[model samples]
Target: MAFDPDAKLSDVLAGGYDLNNRLQALLISRPLDSRGQEAAMAFSQELSRVFMLSLSMLNSNAVAPEVRSGNSSGVSAPAKDKRARSDNGEVVTPSKKSREEGVTRKEITPSPHKDGYQWRKYGQKKIQNCSFSRYYFKCNRHRRCEAKKKVQQQDGGRGRLPPMFKVTYVNEHTCHELRAHDDAAARMASPWTASRHHALDGVVDTARGGGGLFDLLPHIVGGGSAEENEAMVSCLAAVVSGSVPSPPPRSSGWPAAPEASASDPAASFVPPAAAGRSASVADDGAMMMVDDTGVSWDPWWSFCPVEEAAGHQLVTNQNHHRDMHMDDAGGFADAVWPEHACGAWRRA
Candidate 1:
């Protein structure tokens, strides 16, 4: 469980802290065990995803869904899940990246400064013999928030990757920002999640009494293009039928955090079918659990940008672990765990 992202965060963190804990079960390192060569790296990546998600949710400056131009009504699209807007009004949905920089830089960032909280740079200094300067930041609300951070540049990974940073933090935050973020995150989790109660009356009425899955397609896909909706629905039907198969591996994985390209058909997403799918789930309700396997890669998984981005980047691993994850590992190799795995009514 230590290495599995699907486990509870508390469990993962606790297990990681143990000198020899359950996580070691995943470590099969042997003299020439080629299979286990990337185990350590995979563990690190999953752990990084957890840390990134947890910290990012705390960012007060986190970006909200960008309202695409055209909807003159200024009314938000029905599907809050999507990141891009199609001309006819559809976009592939995913947990959006924090446009806050770092991760969004070239869709891959060298900076790790996009933690959940808000900060303001107060000072920067050049070290005696360092090529990169040492910068400092304090909580955005310095008077009420006492947290401070020092970030120093690290060696570029032999130029294979960009420069990394050594970040040090002092003092705990008094901003109570986490609570605020929690509320916002819950709000964004999903409006159409499946739940028995806490569901919107209109949405619920529309679903159980409405047409079959086809009728529900547009609502779930967020109302953009027919192709987008059909593609999403096709995947959903396959998932519901138990045999859920892994998508064929692409030479290059889809962008973990993609910018909307109005010109691209694949990038176009339909409006959310919240009414059809989210019959009742409004917030933190029971997730659509198919198996107790601990990881759920249900249809909703595709729409969650946060989990989707972090999880898919695991493909960057040399072992092609992601391609094998669903059959051997969890499709996501784990999930948002409690955050997403348990979310959506919220996580999706």
Candidate 2:
């Protein structure tokens, strides 16, 4: 069969347009890995170069002479017609030339190039004082494709860092299979798959609306009375709001001590002889506790220190009267009431 140049060029142009549309769709809709994304971008850039070259060829062959003659005619035609022709021809030529120049500059500039495409290794050469060999590769997608590249490592940079590779391209690719392969690889390595796996690990079953804080609290705090749970929640709310709830009146037969203002540092201080006694404070910044034993407790831990007046606001609205107990050994231990309640209270 005889080859027709026009027919072949038309076919190539049609195929390029179709491929460009498909690439744009994939870029928008499909998730891609880093390598695949790089390949897609590089392929897009190459396609743009081809489109620009075609435009330049068409403009030069079809529009240049007519424009030049009109400009040389020296006002022979109407001003509007000449202006319109000049706008179409003269303005476009310089812009196209500048764009082509920019693309050429980018191609020659030395930089790290890792446009993902399958390349077959063809040769390796060792350079003087270099720790690595330079590897040469050719595009293997088509036998006719002349695209080739050389990758070489920069000397003297090493440990814990990525080795610098200088890549040089010799020709453009004729094979179009690189874009399809890149799209496939990108789909396979989509980040959504990893995120879905993570979501499945500890994600609450929120579809049923049952994973609320109150629902989870029973499992976390163990078994407890309803009253104790209510108290625990209220105390937690107060603590979270940066307020300390006042202790109930001393109804457990413990003796009361002298009252003092919260501003005074001496109010929270316990003498070495009187550490075993329980301490309390009045509503108006007064400390009232009587020391019963000589065993001294760290006053800072025993009571909400009077010095922390900003945090120790009395919760007068709370009607629940629960007794507070301090262990003989000075650490928080079992309460005279519910043991589970004490545990919950401590946790709050």
Candidate 2 RMSD computed on C-alpha atoms after optimal superposition onto the true structure: 36.4
What local distance difference test score does each model get?
0.36, 0.36
For 1-348, candidate 2 gives per-residue lDDT tens digits of 122335433344444545565565556555888976986787677676556555555445453333233221122233333222232255333355433422111111112222323355557666556554655656554445556666554453233222334455555665445434543566579955544432311122221124455445544443232322334455577889978544322222211111111111122222211323454433332334333432222323322222121122112111211221121110111111111111101111
Name the candidate that leads on TM-score: 1
TM-score per model over all chains? 0.23, 0.21
lDDT, candidate 1, 230-278, per-residue tens: 3456567778896643332211322111111111111111122211222
- Report residue 87 deviation for candidate 1 (angstroms): 53
Sequence-dependent TM-score of model 1: 0.23
- Spell out the clash pairs found in candidate 2: 257-289, 257-290, 260-287, 273-294
Question: Worst lDDT window (10 residues) for model 2?
Answer: 327-336
Q: How far does residue 176 in candidate 1 sit from its true spot (Å)?
A: 0.9
Report the number of clashing residue pairs per model: 28, 4
